[model samples]
Target: MNGIDIHNYVDCNDMFRAAANFFAACCRCAVAEKGVFNVAISGGSTPDGLFEELVKMKDSLPLEAIQWFWVDERCVKPDAPESNYGRAAKKLLNRLQLQLDNVHRIEAEKPEAAEKYEKIIRTLLPLNKKGLPVFDLVLLGMGPDGHTASLFPEKFNDLPGDKIVLKVPEPEHILPAVPRITLSMQAINSALEKVFLVTGNNKMELLKVIKNGQGNHYPAAGIFQAAWFVCCKPGSQD
Candidate 1:
């Protein structure tokens, strides 16, 4: 519940540029030190902007050294419009020259999908002496409801386990057709860097409440080590 580094931008385009720059820097740093970069990405309108920006910078960005993963994904076929991976594939991954092996997608259609995805993540991650997967960067998004990575305020009680991948039950009226698979808070915080891209006027009040440390009930409150960029209209509060 610590205050995150807040960066406010006048518009979504500016936020996208800044996010792309941050990703490029992290990719370079990881490649220089470890020869590989693992990044977990969230799905939302804000990330779509950043993904388009990254696509534009594909030539300059270190595309080859980075391994892409989703922080959460809707349970759907890869070709579905509702699929987070499908959106990213259309916007960024498909445009890049990076190898298919570098994109580790959540198996949304598999039976026991969350457990299977967890196994895949465990295999790709570099184990420490105690056998924990360490990530280079994790990019997140905030819903107006203050949820992040499929973790909602009402669902906080369900988050205490040590599992890397979690199966989230579908919300009553959510858009996605099935359940969700998301990385747990433990896995998310293990990343070297975490970034959040949030936008729009509807979220300002909740953002303020979160920054004031009044709403620990929200899953977004679990993100203590991340740097957040809030893209708002001109003269919006931070």
Candidate 2:
């Protein structure tokens, strides 16, 4: 089994660079093999820096051939302030001048949005050996409370079985709580590559536990075959 690999950095700039390099590689590999690169991005304060770095990659990579997707989303209007789709647009997509059709966003506000988004994903992506739609790359962020995407600690083991996408309601076990739609574990694990962008001292202890392999109890550790780009205060041991 491919386990999680951790890489620590002194600042987010280096972290974003590493992620952008890995991202460029995934894009090239996917495009060469399938003519399109499917990418899913998580919404958080951490990935914003990575997005900024990626926009500058237009000169070095095939930016136009890349298609974008969201890893999870708040159940709000697409243009809403809290929407992940909105955040990504402001941070990177608009800057890239990507063909608007290539940026697929989840209509999280619709009553049937989960099913609708799942259909969109299925129609847009190719399947892995496991018969799941495999994204070329999936970028994630871990909550200080140990959640990844919207699979919170409170509902870690309870994500929907048959659905490719799940709806998460705010629960007492999580902080910064809100309703959300997220890919299921099976869907996320099927990615060709999974990269986590972790930053700040707030996550230091959590990263320690995760590195020590004590994070199985937390929702964030459920993602498989992942690499973490961590930036934190000094003296934090790997």
Candidate 3:
């Protein structure tokens, strides 16, 4: 990756540990400096291990100073199995005793979920010079087809530049296919730090395309100054 920093690990466990440690470090630093650590996290099975690892470190983390937000959400109730907030809540938040108010989940089932989420982000996060909310950290995951935070390849060109959150009503081909609400590319790029957690041997070839910078059509490739925490070693097979 021309503009990305690559951190390779031998396996999924190692990769999750490294990413969790990185997240903890960022949380401590941000909370120490500004009294708050605001972060937006992506959904998917890939990050579940990282969430579990973080839960194990609950005693050391400044849970009170951390504010949680989601990068995107499916159009389902919070209790649904596929819901990102639901997964994190079960694996991490509930374990850490994080207050409900600090968890800013996107209510994707509502008609104005995107607008409501944008308002909440603006209210809680500090804005940069360009007036974009700056999150202390943004944890992301890249789909096998190169999508990130619900930004798919088919509608890459049609994404709104001025919006903080976008309502994705047409996600017909993707798994768990349904409506979604996601942060715009502008919102993601404005974050102070962004990291992508990529594991599994099946993703090596797609990672190659991203690393070579030939995936302009892919949403994950367009992220600004991203660090890739990858465990899929070259030549590894399932």
The 10-residue segment of model 1 with minimum total lDDT is: 169-178
The C-alpha TM-scores of every prediction are: 0.93, 0.93, 0.96
Q: How far in Å is the alpha carbon of 159 misplaced in model 3? A: 1.5
The residue-by-residue lDDT of candidate 2 on 49-107, one tens digit each, is 88888888888777778889989998888888888899899998888888988988888
Top-down TM-score ranking: 3, 1, 2
Query: What lDDT, from 0 to 1, does candidate 3 have?
Result: 0.89
Residue pairs with colliding backbones in model 2 are none
Q: Per-prediction count of colliding residue pairs?
A: 0, 0, 0
CA deviation > 4 Å runs, candidate 2: 173-176, 235-238
RMSD of each: 2.1, 2.3, 1.4
Q: Regarding lDDT, does 1 or 3 come out ahead?
A: 3
In model 2, how large is the Cα lDDT of residue 177?
57
Query: What tens-digit string does per-residue lDDT give for candidate 1 at 1-238?
Result: 5658889988789888998899889999899998889999987666888988888888876677889999998888888888888888877788785698999989877768888888888898886554556789999988877888988766668665778888887855456646888898878878888899988878988888888899788789888878998888967553
Query: How close to the true structure is residue 96 of candidate 1, measured as C-alpha lDDT?
Result: 84
Please give the CA lDDT of all the candidate structures: 0.83, 0.84, 0.89
Model 2 is weakest, by summed lDDT over 10 consecutive residues, at: 170-179
Indicate the worst ten consecutive residues by lDDT in candidate 3.
168-177
Model 1: runs farther than 4 Å from truth? 128-131, 235-238
